[model samples]
Target: MTQVIRAYVGSLLGFLLLDALWLGFIAKDNYTQAMEGLMRDKVHIWPWIVFYTLYCMAMVYLVIRPQFNAEKASGVFIGGGVLGAAAYGAYNMTNYALLADWPLGISLQDWVWGAVVTSLSSYCGWRLARR
Candidate 1:
């Protein structure tokens, strides 16, 4: 029970930090251009809050826990990356398929970022929880 709490908190922090870096510094321009008119003038906080909460939970449960249980750090990292790629790719690809004028560039970049960020975050969380 304690492990689960620690994992959730650690992964949440990790995910937020990494995502902030990616969204705020690295891919800000790309998102702005891609979203263009599709974006709301004012950012809505609720959806993002919900997204991160759910995402971190899923990351910890589905990716980190199994690896932690198996005592495999490498597996945590690799599985996190794969899971991130698959999850984000599903969202992006579905948007591209369903939404008119969705930018392929944004989707591709997001897929890459998702894999990298999730891998690092999950690893950090697993390490912290293990300690």
Candidate 2:
């Protein structure tokens, strides 16, 4: 139980840190704008992001690598990322369904980016576990 709790916290912290690292490095290091963006309703699914991600990861970990600990967290992250991408795709679809506007190839792009980052985060956690 302690281990699972530890795993959850460890994974969450690592995920947040990694998210910040990339957001800072490439997204012009702008939090104010991000805050503003999250505060809106058009793309205002901000509250769902954290819990949804961790939950997806947890599902992935429990299913795929129950023994890998930190490494398992990576799988969870990738799982969660895939979930996130699907969500964005779904959100766009629902909004533009009437207009018939789809993201087409952009969904692929999000998938790639999300997978890469999530994998990196999971890998970092796995390596940190050193077992």
Clashes of each: 0, 2
Summarize candidate 1's per-residue lDDT along 8-99 as a digit string, tens digits. Answer: 88888999998998889888998998889788888999998998899888988998888776756889889889989998999999999999
Highest lDDT: give the candidate number: 1
In candidate 2, what residue range of length 10 has the lowest lDDT sum? 28-37
Query: Any idea what lDDT model 2 has?
Result: 0.50
Which parts of model 2 have CA positions greater than 4 angstroms off? 28-53, 56-60, 63-65, 69-106, 127-131
Clashing pairs in 1: none
Q: TM-score of the candidate numbered 2?
A: 0.48
User: With candidate 1 superimposed using the best TM-score fit, by how many Å does residue 120's alpha carbon deviate from the native?
Assistant: 1.1
- RMSD (Å) per prediction: 1.2, 6.0
